[model samples]
Target chain A: MQLRQLSLRPFRNFARIDLEFAEGGAVIVGANGRGKSNILEAICYQSIGKSIRGARDHEAVPHGEGHFDIRGDWQQGQRRHPCRVFYGADDGKRVFLDEAPLPRVSDLVSHFQTVYFAPQDVALVLQFSAQRRRLLDIVLSQADAVYLKALQTYQRLLTQRNHFLRSLGHRGVDPTEREVWDAQLAKPGALLRHHRLLGLVEIMPDFARQYDVFSTGQETAGLLYADEVIESNPDEIPTRDQLEATFRQQLRDGFEKERHAGHTLNGPHRDGFVFTIDGEAADAFGSQGQQKSVLLSWKMAELRLLERRKGQQPLLLLDDVFSELDPIRSAHLIEMVEDFDQVILTAPRQPQESLGDRYARIDLE
Target chain B: MGPEPLEDLVVAFTRLPGIGRKTAQRLALYVLKSPPQEAESLAAAVRAARENIGHCTRCFHLTERGQELCHICRDPRRDTGMICVVEEASDALALERSELMRGTYHVLGGALSPLDGVGPEDLRIAELVERVREEGIREVILAHNASAEGEATAEYIHQRLDGMTQVSRLARGLPAGSDLDLADRTTLAHALQGRVQF
Candidate 1:
């Protein structure tokens, strides 16, 4: 799916902004913090009901405003569609597809499989495992509804469990009450882990191939799920039997401790995704350039996977990421996106004369 | 002018997960107006809780003893042959309200969500299977919510089990799109009692 037009009202620095996209591609050019990222943020908000920068709903409102609104016209498959998202100070946020209210944010992901690249994406390789896991999640969630549902359920349980833990010491709750939460938390948690392991298995080969492209075939990349319960032994990845047994044992052992401490400590929240280059941890050992290349390869693999699965190219949002890379990497990125049906790139300035005339630029002041 | 302590309090509060600036200010003023002893106790409570509580070695549940086993694991009356699986410990408590499940439980910590980058390896799935095998569990009930990830997680477990033992899922009594914990006690109890074979 590709965005054809976007309209924003009191969103970020844009008081009332309307912009249209060409059939092929559009380049948004602006100085730093001149509402360039805001425009992209608006698109992301309408598509996914959240900001790429992790802005809260109220934060998305202009500095002095209490409400923010975004509307987008897009083409998915053979049909043209209009989608809108509105956030208000008094009321909760709402999403509309072709003017009809959606039941959930996951419904929006069904319409548009968007892959965004921000400068922070470089951190995918260098930052904590959560970032890398998020990278995998955004891509896999769009591709599979089951994955989205599992994630939602898992997170909801985690929040509830933590809340219970927080209240345990203060509230007059029974000791047995904690057992109930343990039983409920385990089922989905196990299922979530199963899905992640499968997703990595399915996407790892593709990730490796793309990594080779970005790394000039000098590095071999691999993704591994690292957890005390799942694969404690590097030589023998624990079988499902072993993993489940460990889970039960851990819960059994921790029951009284959970009540005493008022918190659930074990599970996916503590898990990490391990990225390796030639059997070495990437985050600890990879250089800045290598990290960037790893992230680019992962994102490119995401694009290819979505295109293959959806039978349509997704709209690509590149948010001022070009400045972080060298000219060669920038050129490689440009070449990678050349065949996309729609690409929206934000940069400090227009590309040099060498980029030719394939892209249309829009200036934001 | 000196730094505005009130403003700093508001900013700090806003940094929390859900608290906004306005709520933060309300909280700060409440603390400021409270008795000195109360404020000191609150401060002491925060530090004491963080330092005293830690994960149980056996179940990974938070505790103060730093012991290997939790209370439930220590309970001899609970059914050891049956295990109710869930995303977090809170679900275990919600189930306990029904008083229908007599068996023990295993907390996996989360459901499989590939998009959010959560996977089986992130959760406690392997440990769950191990618990089942080592404990001689006769039945494993998959109690994840009825969502895509929940179903996928159940399927993944079913595949891994490979008929080592019977595995079932919580029945579809809860609303099509709803959370299990949010369901009323009656609904949750019924769902658990009516679980179906996976």
Candidate 2:
């Protein structure tokens, strides 16, 4: 999907601006604090229905302003969709596809797809397991609606089950309620584990190929879904029933342990995603550059999966990340990115690498 | 400024569900401009309804004051062996409107939601269990909504009533007259899962 025109009203630092994007998309060059990233954030906010920077809706509204509105026309092949998102202090957020109002914000996710890459995404590999899980979740959620629904259901059940477990620490909570929550949670939990495992399995081959492209194929890279219930066999996908049984058994056996912890101690919520280089853990054995390579490969693999699943090339939003990469990686990244129809890039200044003339350049003061 | 009583009246209107301050003020002004008899009749009707309505002893459904059993429970022709359990009194009424079930109804006050501090003891689960035991119920059809809390409540009740009587839940699928293309993926998936052999 490609954005044709974007108009932001009182959003972030921009009081008002209208951008007409080219077929190759545009690069916004500016000094720091000139809202270059904010433009990317506004574009991403339309796709995901919230700030990718994790800012609240009210925060996007400028100081002394009561509301913000973003309007854009997105093109996918021959069809063009007019999208509008309006947020008010009084009326909350409303999204429209074409001219009709979307009943739910989640409905808008599949309408527009974006793969947002920023400089901080390097933390996906070096930081906590949650970051990797979130990346996997975002990719999978945008690609598959069933996975998104299951994820929402799993999160809700996990919250309720944890709340009930906490109440078990005190009096007046029925012990049998544990069985109720277990039965309720097992289906979605197993589904989440299944999808996460399948996602890694499907993406691992491309992930390794992308890593080889970046690393000169010297060492073999691998992705692992570190799950206790289902064996991570890339050759064979685990059935949801297999996952559900093991999940139920784990919940039963770990009840006492969970009670001691005052919350859930098992299931996919605690599952680990590990990146391995030459059969060794990458975070422990690899250098910082190697970690960033793994992250980049994983993101490219995500983009491929999105394209394969949705049958559309997702809009790639690159935010101030080109300058952070070394010359070799940046050159290779540019080579890979040139194949895409639309690419939105931001930088502190025009990068040394000359992006081809297909990219429309815009400078902000 | 209007008098304190008018402000108090607006406040009272706002106390009701889904009434905002603006809506409350509008209602207060509308009431003020209306005839005196209209306000008196409205007040008398609210007072009479509050005084006359009470819950049935068995099902917890709204019944006339001093009634032991609701009209459904008192009907001799209705099947006493099967009880359709629902999450709310309104749910029971909805199922009754379908005219499909010949059994009596059991209205659980609400579903079990521990996060909201609602437990089995807070709902009418114990009463339903007692009725199933003492009233010779053969089957309890669980008509709870298809929400997590509702499913948990149904499972809990099924556990409690294990081996004593058969328990079942309502079949969920596409709404009547809804086109298959219009069904959301989740609903379509559910309908596929619950599809019957024709």
Candidate 3:
């Protein structure tokens, strides 16, 4: 699948812009804060119904505009499917696939697959555990609906459990109801962690391989899932039942701590991955180059994992990431990126390694 | 925004499921623009339905004229041994409209949603249990929805009727006329998992 064209209206810095792509993909070139990344955001947002930069729909709208519109025409050989997304400040978001309303965000994910890469994605590995979990989830959710449903179920139950906890502190409530919520939460929560573990297992080699390709260091690369529920070997994926039992015990044990905090604490939401370089935590010990390599390799693994799982090459969106890469890594990235079916690169100046006819350059003014 | 009666009508429309403020406003305006007889008849229909339509004592289906039992329950040809339980009256109505299921119906009123403080006692679950135990039900098809709450409610009901009668859930898979390639991942997974031997 290929994104044939992208049109953005009243979205962020772009007042109204439309660009028709040359076959493979296009390089959106412009200076900082010039709406180059916004174009990439629009494309990724339409496919995923989310902001890669964590901006809300209201914030994505232009200063004077109350809403934003993004439409991308996709072509798979002879078939042309137009995907459109609309976001209103007051009305929420809506997506249309070939002019039919898609009611669910998860349903929209695989319609146009994208892997968004930027400098701060290191934070995905080095900082917040949620971002690391999201790294695994975003890929898995797009490929398998079962995983997505399980994730949604787990999130809803977590919200309910947390709400119960918050209420438990202020007023007297039924302890029996907590059992029901916990029972429901355990099943899906275990499934989520199990999938994340399986996701790591499946992509660990690809992650290491990509790291070797991108990194200058000679130390061994590793991605370990630091689960709070169960002690899982970094190499082995635990079964759902095993994780479920542990999750239930942890939730039960957390009752006292959770009561005082007024929020449920131990679950997949608190889980994170620790990226390692030669048995050392990358975030704490690795150099700047190693950290950037960790993020790049992880994202690259994501692309490969999605392709292997879904049997379709996902579109790669490079959002001002080339600026952060060294000359060798940038060259390596451009080479590997060319192999993807589609890649939309956002950069201040055109990279030295150019795709002659395979790329179209758009300058955001 | 409108006069007292018009605003009241719109607000009334808004109280119904899926009817938003804008739709309610449009409906109210449509009623206002129509002939006086049309508005009067609409009001009469709502008032009459609310006053007359009540849950049947036997099947829990909505019955008009304050009937003791719904028409399906009163029908002698319908099977008495099989009871298909649903979460809402509308679900039973849908099954009846489909012209499937010769069995009687029992509306649980709503599923067991613990988050909302609803449990077995909140629904007509105990009544359902009693009916199955005393009525000598051979099989109880649990036709509850596939949501989390629905699953829990079905499980709860299943445990109650486990030894008393054979309880089964509704079949889930792809809808008819959907191609395998075009079907969503979830539906396709369900269809494949529940596939019959060819």
Candidate 4:
């Protein structure tokens, strides 16, 4: 999907701004604090239906303003879609596609595919498991609708089960109730883990190869799905029935532990993906530059995965990460920019290298 | 603020489901502009309903204050041997609108939602069990909403009544008139899973 035009109102530092994108996407350049990142944020929000920086909806509203509105004209193949997202303090958030309101915010997923890369995303390799889990969720949610629905169901059931456990006072509750909850949870939990492991499996080779290209070949890269419910080898994507059976068994076996902890102790919620370099945990052994390389390679693999699954080039948003990259990684990003259908990147100063004839430059004051 | 009575009316309207502040204000204004007797009648209806309506002795459905049974329970033509269980009286009413079911209903008042502090004790599950055993019901149809909590409630009831009598859940699939394209992906998947022989 390509973002043809974008308009923002009362969004963060930009009270109002409108820009028409070029065929190859535009490079937004401005000094620090000039709202260069806000442009990319607006475009990302229009695609993903929320603040990409993890800010709450109201936080994006300008000072003393009650709401923020983002409008984008997107193109895919021969079809053009006009999308609008409006959030108000009183009415909450609403999204529209072709002038018809979507029933849920999640309905916006996969409609306009985008892959966003920011400096903070390096945390995917060097930070807590939640970041990597979120990366999996974002990529899968954008590539497959069923994955998004299953993910939403799994998260909600996890919360409800946790609350139910807390309400039980940690013991002596009837086992049938737990059985009911386990049966309810295992169905969606299995779907979540099945897709997660499948995604990791599909992206592993690409991830490994891209990491080698981005870094010295002396080290080998590996991705492993760390699951709590079912034990599987790195290459084995278990069937849904096997996953469900194992999930139910784990929940039954972990009842006492979960009851003691006052929450659920097993399921996809507690699962994660482990990135390793040279057969060692990258988060613990890799240097800062190595971690950046890991994240960059993972992102490139994610782009490929999305393209293969979506059958089209997804909009790539690079948020001012060029200065942080070495020449090698920067060269890789520029090559990716050329390969992609649209790329909107924000930088403090324009890179010296050319981005071909179709790329446009926008300077913000 | 406007007049205290008008504000009070708006607040009361706002307490109703799906009524926001703007909708409540509009409803209050409409009530104020209507004839005084119309307002009096609405108030009287609400008061009378609250005062007179009570749970049926056996099924927990709304009935007259002093009545021992609801109209369906009192009807001799209805099949007392079969009972349909539901989460709320409104659901029972929706089922009754079809004019297809000939059995009586047992309203559980609500489903089991431990997150909301609702449990088996909070609902009329024990009473349902008691009626099934004492009344010699042949089949119990679990007609609760198709939600996680509702399914859990059904599971709980099914376990409680295990081996006591035959039990079945309502068939879940696409609506009759809805096109296959109109159904959501989850619903479509469910319909596929629950598909039967042609």
**DockQ of all predictions against the true structure, Cα-based:** 0.03, 0.74, 0.25, 0.72
Q: Tens digit of lDDT per residue, candidate 2, span B1-198?
A: 479999999999999999998999999999999999999999999999999999998888889998888989888999999999999989988988989889999899998887897878889888988998999999999998888888889999999999999998887889999899878888888899999999
- In order, the TM-score of chain B in each prediction is 0.74, 0.91, 0.95, 0.97
Clashes of each: 69, 0, 0, 0
Better of 1 and 3 by DockQ: 3
Worst 10 residues of 2 chain B by lDDT: B112-121
Candidate 2 residue-wise lDDT, A147-209, digit = tens = 888888888888888888777766654767778999889999999988888888778888888
lDDT of 4 by residue, B24-43 (tens): 99999999999999999999
Instruction: Sort candidate 4 into its docking category.
Output: medium
Q: What is the interface RMSD of candidate 1, in Å?
A: 13.6
lDDT, model 2: 0.85
Q: Which ten residues in a row have the lowest lDDT in candidate 3 chain A?
A: A227-236
DockQ category of candidate 3: acceptable
Quick one: best DockQ, which candidate? 2
Real contacts retained, model 1: 0.00
Instruction: Place model 1 in a CAPRI quality band.
Output: incorrect
Over A1-365, each residue of candidate 3 has an lDDT whose tens digit, in order, gives: 78888888878888888899877888888888787877888888876778877767788888878999999998876899999889897788888899999877667876678888887557555666666667777778776668888988887777767766776654665455566667788999998887887777777888888998998867778876773222224545668998999998998898989978877788888876788888777888888888888888888989888888878888888877767888889888888876788888888987776556677888877
Q: Where does candidate 1 stray beyond 4 Å?
A: A163-179, A227-246, A254-261, A353-358, B1-198
Candidate 3 collision pairs:
none
lDDT of 3 by residue, B148-182 (tens): 77876787777667689888888789887877677
Error at A93, model 4, angstroms:
0.9
